[model samples]
Target: MSLRYTFINVLVSIALLSSCSTPKGITYMQGMFEEMPQEIIQQSRITVQPDDKLSIVVSSKDPELAEVFNLAVARHQVGQSITNNNNMQQTALFTVSPSGFINYPVIGEIYIAGLNRQEVAQLIQKELISQNLLKDPVVTVEFMNTTVSVLGDVSHPGEYPIDRDDLNVIQAISKAGDLNITGLRENVLVVRKKDEKNIAYRLDLTNAQSLFQSPAFYLRQNDIVYVEPNNMKKRQSTVNGNTVQTPSLWISIISLLTTISVLVFK
Candidate 1:
């Protein structure tokens, strides 16, 4: 084949290969319409896990009586006045141990892992009533550490607190400062733990319709959302602080060599 034809083929190949990510890939919810029916997607429930910090509050009609079953939170000096203590009232945060149990004031150590926030509160309330400690105890439980990790190719990659229990993948991405321009919008990875093993789910944000059907649609506490970098961004990244040639670089090098040979041989 002629050198001119070879060079043309080389240039065309580079141009085609360079188009790794297109404008369509960058656009989110492509082909979506205003008349499209919305799908009902249920948010995942966050279960209490080991090392989870929980705030449990016990309340009843008789304030003095309820205080007996509650742990005294030392907000200030122990000898502080009642008014000062009231102003600084704070529930003592309970940290679930590795064994999935918390040392309660009266019930001693009780397993709480794998239980939801409401179920945990109900368990405590039942214990109080069963022990005849209180006629009817009202217990409230809230997760003090409902955070999700957003890492890789994101504007802000770190642990973000999820105030709402019904958080989803889209919300998690928004909290991470949204995916950067370099992030691979089509391939986002969600890492979750189950049965002491890690399970990863891939989500395509470019297709909003399919995203609803994704298993990672609802984000669980401590779930990790990893946005991988696209080809362009991967090429820009350095290896060990040293510049490395990506596939495009090698292709460019070959094209240059082929063109040089064509001119030298012509």
Candidate 2:
């Protein structure tokens, strides 16, 4: 074959091979089934932890008698309107001690760490009714500092309050304005705390159907969700798109090499 024809053929073959190489990790969830396998994960309720702020409010038909059981909220009167305080249920801010106890107005020190919100409220209510302090007492418990953090490739990354007890990774991301387009859906990270130690897990969310089966699907209080950037964002592109290098520049290099080879062979 003539040098021009042979060079053109070689260039075409190189272009085809490069195209194949570029698709190695260019796509996510390439062959996922529509219906994912169902795995049973025991949904655990969020228990109280050390350093958590709690607000306990006790009430009954008589507001005067109930006043003794509850503490007072402290703050500066913002023109006697409202104060910039968190909405934990405590009339006065009560910090859970390291020993897992809080000293109440009349109940004294009550060990509450590791118990769910309902359990704590029930315990307090029982104590009051048994002691004849109040009849048909109603107790309310609030986790004032229950929050989760969203970071990395999300649209809005920050700590968000968990109004409800149960939260999932998907909802947590949604609270932070969802993940950006460049985020790697298949490599979402969840960092959780257990026994005062942090543990991390890698979750694949590209196949939306399987997100429910992930171990990290249900997030705990103070858990952090970090969505990493996809390979496209890591790439350095010039007009073509993001990535290591532009395809046109690579093609030019191949062309120069081919020209050199043709000259030597000729």
Candidate 3:
């Protein structure tokens, strides 16, 4: 073969090899068959914690009786008494104390931390009935400030509110626009704070059973899901933090050189 033909062949071979190299572990929940066992599906529930804000509302057949148990926002001027009208009173957010208690009206200090919304509501309902406060009372509880933080290698890394009672890790990741292709899905880290101690769990998105069985699969309030960058991304960051040294850049350079050589040889 001539010198020009050999040069072209070499450039073509390099480009082919670079193009054929595919990234592994990019697909999530690998080996997830169509017929998944019922035991593998885990139920996730959000539990209340200290520093959490809750919105509790009490309702009964008699509106006046239930109003005494519900918390209301009251505004007062310097010269006026703290007068609150039923129409003007809005449901106020109750902040859980550091000791995991909320000083609810009529009920006094109630320990709600470590309990889910349904449990909290039930506790309040039972309190009203047992204390003879309301014959037919209904209590509803909602988490006002529960959120999860997603960071690193995600399209949108920020705090996403836990709107529902069961916000799992997969849903949280989806809220952040899913992980980028350069993210290391095989080793995603989930950091959680339980009992005032920070606990970390590693989850592999490529494995279906492992992800479902991990405790981190069910994300809690203030949970942090961090997606580390893959090896190629780390190398790109180390090398001037640009695409100049990437395989695509080399392919472009080789294509340009080949075009010039063909013109000269012709």
Candidate 4:
């Protein structure tokens, strides 16, 4: 064969070989087909925190008394009204005071901060019995406005409702449509509010072991998950169906082109 034809044949073979090679660090290609560890499943519980709006319901032999408690709990729902009168106003959901108490009808001032919905319901049930409000009161609690914020490198970024108490980092990410390819999988950051202070935790999803040891693996109410972009994605943003690239993005583009050329030629 002529040298020119031989070079083309070799290039095509190299290209085909390179295309078949599995990318490094990909979970599917790595031999990890077993089920996740038991410890990971056990460590997925998330406790409730302060400033979390909850719906507390109480029932009793006397529905009237239960209705009173329900009404009291409903009063705690906070928000504002905007009318065509052109007036705009905003209001808080639950107003837990610095003393950790909220004013409830008949129950008076009750401490609710730092308590989960179930605990709050139990407390209210005890209060009703002690106050002679009802006999054998049954209580139920639900999070009325519990939400967590998802940001950075997700299909949809915004606050999502906390429907269940067992929501974890992976489920939260899934709720926001999972991380984009450009997202940093090994270094996701979760910001939370604890003890009237802001705290942050780093998570590594790439390692199966990290699923058990990482504190951020379980999501808390008002928790913020931020998926930083990979190095190449940080410098580029797509708008109007066009890619806007910075110096770093251009470098990555050139590197990719060079890789394609080398694999084809070799």
Alpha carbon deviation, residue 153, candidate 2 (Å): 2.0
Whole-model lDDT, model 3: 0.87
Where does candidate 3 have its weakest 10-residue lDDT segment?
Answer: 76-85
Looking at model 1, which ten-residue stretch has the lowest summed lDDT?
A: 237-246
Which pairs clash in model 3?
none
lDDT of 1 by residue, 159-260 (tens): 999888778888888888888887898999999987679999998888877887777888888899999998767666655322333566666776787777
Per-model TM-score versus the true fold: 0.73, 0.74, 0.80, 0.67
What's the alpha carbon RMSD for model 3?
4.4
Please tell me which predicted candidate would have the highest TM-score against the true structure: 3
Quote model 1's TM-score: 0.73
lDDT sort, best first: 3, 1, 2, 4
Q: Write the per-residue lDDT of candidate 4 for residues 1-266, one digit (tens) a residue.
A: 35545655565565557547774532411223556555654544444454556555666777765676665312322357324331332222454566677767677998877676667778888888898888888877776767889999989989998788778788888899988888887788999887778999987777657655667777778899998988667555544222433344545655576566657766
TM-score of 2: 0.74
- The parts of candidate 3 lying over 4 Å away from their true place are 1-15, 34-43, 75-88, 239-245, 248-266
Q: Which stretches of model 4 miss by more than 4 angstroms?
A: 1-21, 24-48, 72-94, 237-266
lDDT of each: 0.82, 0.80, 0.87, 0.68
**For candidate 3, lDDT tens digit of each residue in 131-240?**
99899989999899999999999999999999888788888999999999999999999999988799999999988878887888888999999999977788775656
TM-score of 3: 0.80
Best by lDDT: 3
